[model samples]
Target: MIKIEDITFVAAEAYKRSGLVLSTDKGYLLESRLAPLARAEGYPSIEALIAAARRESNDRLLWAITEALATHETFFFRDNTPFDLFKQEILPVLSRARGNMSTIRIWCAACSSGQEPYSLAMILEEEKARLGGLRFEIVATDMAPRVLEKAKAGVYSQFEVQRGLAIQRLVTHFDQSGDQWRIKPNLRSMVTFQKQNLLENFSGMGTFDVIFCRNVLIYFDADTKKRILQRLAAQTASDGYLIMGAAETVVGLSQDFAPVEGRRGLYGRSGAAKSAAA
Candidate 1:
């Protein structure tokens, strides 16, 4: 059994590094997730691993702990509504507003294992003729190096592809290699994946016409959520949209964005923002 003190340390360290809250009740997760890592690192137990990590101040091990605790629960087009809204509502609006000459910039924050961005890429491909020659740039970012590597490879197992990926899309956008499916080179090229931490400054990453930060903020505390929402707002174009997970919202947490009428999880620059700009 993992000790309370060790659980506290792990929780605190994870929050410090990733802004992920790990309450004491989640001690079981620490044990289950970190056991393999502990054994791999030559520690007899999670306690010893945490002890050594603390004593040696091992940044690598600490980061491994954070990564292990991170919820990488995602699949291609995980939620159908968001993608439908993007393809049906968001794209038409963007195409009309920006015209064919301008490119649409999309940032998929915390995109896990490449599914989310790839889903968007597939939509763009399907709608290419409809878009009137408008170009698109997709930048996908995640905090974990391990997932980013998998995302860059553009490969997924049979089971992975089965989740949320239609057989038709699979046939069109992927080439079967043994038991794995590899995303077509053209589709893979549509997204640029990079390592990014939401806790850090986003000034270098310029504004985006659409930001998909879905299902990410629920892991953080209130302050952290507010901070991330504010940063996201700053990176959003004045008329751009912010799409979050169904469970997350800008209400009470931030005044930088307001919900797009009748659209769940879709937000635009708030009235307060407009007044401030005016």
Candidate 2:
């Protein structure tokens, strides 16, 4: 039997050690996630899993416990409005700014299971001819190696493709692999996926024209959010854009980023906005 209070305490501790701010109101949520993990790992009971969490030698088990709390919903072209803004407003400005050099480099942080990056590849492919000589490259990173490997393989199940993916796009871009759909080689080639932890240093990552860190900040605390925004600012080009989730914001978190005029959920470095104003 799982001791509710004991499992709850361990779950919260694991999340903290994982660098995520676990919500206190999620008692039932933790139980639901932990129950499956306990059963699959051959733990005699959820209590056994909680006890294993206390043991320092079981690093893999501890990590598994922490990772369970990171569950979130993801889909291709998740929120339509942001992608629309990217296509209509952002891309053209960046393309024009590049002038003689025709390249657009974009980074997608916290990309899970490859849907988001694959969506980006599709949009860029559509815009390729219009941009003249511009070549679009995407660097997508997620903290989970398991998911990163899956993303790199460019394969998705029927249910995953059904969400936010239109029939026309499905027919054009994916080849049937048994019951699963695999992204075409050409489209898959456009994105490079790797494992990256947001809390760590990313100085070696060159500045990008646009950075998509959407729907990820809500899981972090105030200080972590601010620190991440600052890191992202350092890696974003002066004229580049940063897009977050619809519900997320930069207000009071970091002064370096300000919302773009007439655009919601889009931000640019304050210094860049000031330069544009001048």
Which of the numbered candidates is closest to the native, going by highest lDDT?
1
Per-residue lDDT of candidate 2, residues 1-278 (tens digit): 44567656765666555457755566676678888989989987777887876765477877677766675468999998778877887877887788745778899998988888899889888777787877777999887776788899988999999999999999899999789999999999999887788877787888898999999998888888988999999999888899999899999999989988767789998867522221
Residue clash pairs of candidate 2: none
TM-scores for the candidates:
0.96, 0.92
Which segments of candidate 2 are over 4 A away from where they belong? 1-13, 274-278
lDDT of 1 by residue, 70-114 (tens): 999899998898899898888888888799779999999999899
Misplaced by over 4 Å in model 1 are: 272-278
Which run of 10 residues does model 1 get worst, by summed lDDT? 269-278
Best by TM-score: 1
lDDT of 2: 0.82
